[model samples]
Target: MNLIAVYTTLIVVLLIWIGARRNPLMALVEIGREMLRSYKFILIIVGMFSVLALNKYELQIERKMHLAADYTSFVFGLEGHFVRHVQELFYAPWLTPVIVFFYIFMLQSVLAASLGIYLLDKNRVLLYATCYTIILTYAIAIPFYLYFPVNEVWSYVPAGVKFTMLEVFPRFEQEYRPLSGLNNCFPSLHTAISVSMALLAFRSGNRRWMVISGISAVVIVFGIFYLGIHWLTDMLGGTLLAVVSTTVAVKLAKLTLRSGEDRLRVRSRATHTR
Candidate 1:
């Protein structure tokens, strides 16, 4: 079996083991539940790996579908127009990575909040919403990556322009290069994930967190464009995905709750009668 298949099997086995520890019947149910919760994340990770594998093994496929040249050129042109303005406004030598780090950390924070709420009494509404949003974002993003794979503008911009910006934020540019990829720029995952966290904060009744997330999203969106990591269109796509994913997650969570509640009621009655 391929690595994908192997990994999928391992995940399934792990879930089963986790479920069985609870009780055989409960374990079976939990396996299904966990699969529903986690399948989207798995698929997204798989899609990324598949892209990497294909690039490694299939040059022809990469050449045919590659949007690197066009996307990079477009972003370069856009950045050229706004680069100076952005630098004047927010291009601090030390603040760029701090902002980026906070953006990533917010994702973890949102995940923790969602999990905490679920553990505190199983708020299916929140649980479903969070998982569904994450899955939906992955689902939408994978297709965009396949169809409109774009490299970061840093890959192809003129050396003169690159060096000028690098001078202002040398450390920021260097630190960003290792973590940010050239491909996967059509729909900015940063924006998508940021919006996801913001929406989650809103849904979970953390108004303060929502405000912080909103501000962070705005900053990250600016950072992405100003840094030439993504185009404006990519940010728009991320926003759309965030909205759609959050909506779907809320709906799915509601359905799951209804089903779970109905099952529990029936089980309780049966136990009483016995």
Candidate 2:
């Protein structure tokens, strides 16, 4: 992934969102100004990268743990019966293009859902919460990645089953493996992030985004499964992670708000007493 393109696109999305309410040129300048003023926004980016960097180092340890552990049976046995049907349905020749599209576009969907709420709906609380939820997911997942480095389902194909994300997207391995460790497949972060964005969109009171995000999240779940990148259990793990992270993010935002309010209340009392 070209990180620059990803962020540049996010910024453009932000500009477009702001443009809806103001002059397009003014919206662009205002977004630039807001980026400069919003230390929290910068900090959120910093926090996400910090966790990601830590992941590379931690994955080394996880790799060692992977060599020492045998978790394939544990994970595969728990995979639901419907997972096979899902794989069969998704692996169809005609659906190959759709699966590939969803695999790559899932992150953009997340950006749209979360940033749309912030930029269009003007819900800073929900924005902060969404960022926090994303980071919290990383924090939670890294530990699992470290201890339980389950390989992708592609490595453990059942009799008569096939895995095609690699076959279809020939460059995927060369491109994706460099950035991500091979064994970080226990709980799918893509699924978790997508699901969390959907949840937040619903909570954001924007019906349009809610529908869009909800549908995108479901597609992403199937995309991961059909691509043989994750098992049914990974999606379940991701869903649970999303719920936990969203709850934590909401609490974090509320706590920050409460603390700010308390400081203001203290100042008011101090001024009156003086």
Candidate with best lDDT: 2
Those runs of model 1 whose alpha carbons end farther than 4 Å from true positions after fitting are 1-70, 74-80, 158-180, 260-274
lDDT for every model? 0.54, 0.67
In angstroms, the error of model 2 at 145 is 0.7
**Tens digits of lDDT, candidate 1, 181-212:** 45667677778877876776565544444465
Model 1 is weakest, by summed lDDT over 10 consecutive residues, at: 265-274
lDDT for 105 in candidate 1 is 48
Model 2, 16-46: lDDT tens digits are 4432343334444544554685766678767
77, model 2: CA deviation in Å? 2.3
- For candidate 2, the lDDT comes to 0.67
Alpha-carbon error at 21 in model 2, in Å? Answer: 7.2
**Sequence-dependent TM-score of model 2:** 0.79
